[model samples]
Target: MSSNSPFPSLLDGTLSLPVTPLIRGALEHSKKITSPTTVNHCIRSAYFAILLSQKLARKDAEPLDAELIVYSVIMHDLGWAVDKSLLSKDKRFEVDSANMARTYLQSTKESGVWDKHRVQLAWDAIALHATPSFSQHKEPEVMLASMGILADFQGHFIANQLITVDEFKAIVGAFPRLGFKDQFIGIMCGLCAYKPETTYDNFVGEWGCEFGLDGKGTGKEEYAKNRLASTFPRTLLPTLIALAEYENEAPAE
Candidate 1:
């Protein structure tokens, strides 16, 4: 790479990463809004996603969009901002984050650089990044974002193989974990404390229930024991029963 080249080549120059003014701006914007831990987490997730994208591209013979992946990852946690004033009272954090990303990306819509489709992709990627079972089935960009986030938290299974152990170490060295487990859980608990209803359907609800849901230093260890969520072994029966009446009254197709 020339001295004038703006793009970054990481992992000992083996991987070339795209860095546009928008990408740089987004990263700066992320640092400005969220906690340092969350910012580092997003950066780490972006690298993981890009690495995973490269491996998946080689396997499927389809190249993934690195810039879009970075864009999606960097802003994926805007909903976890420490300042409650920046968040909505009722929307899930994932939705809140997705909306923020969409609004930011939309500014470039008229320029045709960030067109409707690309913006939508970024939105979907951010919104679904927490839902692996679902996101993995979506578009490549969406799946990569989710996979990358999971990789950071769970140590990508391919760490030693497709992504070298040394490379992973480099990523960690550049963007330290910063006690992510406790810090991330604390952020989620804060959300649950503020908006329990918004988290009722997601994985975070369990976290809320297991940890301190009241947000007043109280752990609701037994809170979910007798609740329908835990006692009921059956899954869709409640939903099916709720809609069964409507189905019985409808005309046959």
Candidate 2:
């Protein structure tokens, strides 16, 4: 679609552009169901993954599957859609999005292009993208996908090492952030409201405890109790309280 190069020098001619019907279908599906902010984020994440792979010279060790990468990244956040029917309460948002991506892959006209192994790779990437320790050790597809996501959200310090500032501007210029930080948190909070257990033991749970889910507290007391119980000395209680208060007042941006 957009002819913008993800990385001016690294990914200029190395990576294959997604142009097949299945890939196009995935992009269209993502745009229809997800917000523009999310769709842009997914595109940026895919590009970032490719750039990271090129930077690490992992193309030969772990070949890039252009179609699979596009499909996986584009659909990774679909579970966070405002349409509750698209998500599953029985699973975490990550698993829900992964399952949806898998199902879409299985039903595509070019489904044969991706075998069971490839499908599983994409699934694992989406499901474990939030867990660096786990995803970083998996297959190239999984690891790179997660890295791309991390780079987009939390890798600002390492951006210079990964790609040039001009390249970064090009990527974000094409797909603007558009208040992604606050919007993403709001989406996670909504997920917590729908399925509280899904957020437990994850970063979303911490956000819930800090911000309160849908303006209603979700396990705030339990989270506080756990923090208090885990602390070694009661003497640190006042300091912890002060820090928590400051954090609560701090801007999420």
Best by lDDT: 1
Instruction: Identify the runs in model 2 with alpha carbons over 4 angstroms from their true place.
Output: 1-16, 58-62, 215-253
lDDT of 2 by residue, 200-227 (tens): 6577767767766653566567654554
Candidate 2 all-Cα RMSD: 11.1
Candidate 1 Cα RMSD after full superposition onto the native fold (Å): 4.0
lDDT of 2 at 170: 65
Residue-wise lDDT of candidate 1 within 1-253, one digit each (tens)? 6554434467887665567777777887788889999998998888888878777676545767778888889999999987889889989999999998787776753223776787888999999999988898988889899988888887645445566678778888878899998887787777767877677677877777767765344656544442335333455777778878886586877
lDDT against the true structure, per candidate, is 0.78, 0.75
Error of 2 at 109 (Å): 0.7
Runs off by more than 4 Å, candidate 1: 1-8, 59-62, 108-112, 156-162, 214-253
**Prediction 2 global C-alpha lDDT:** 0.75
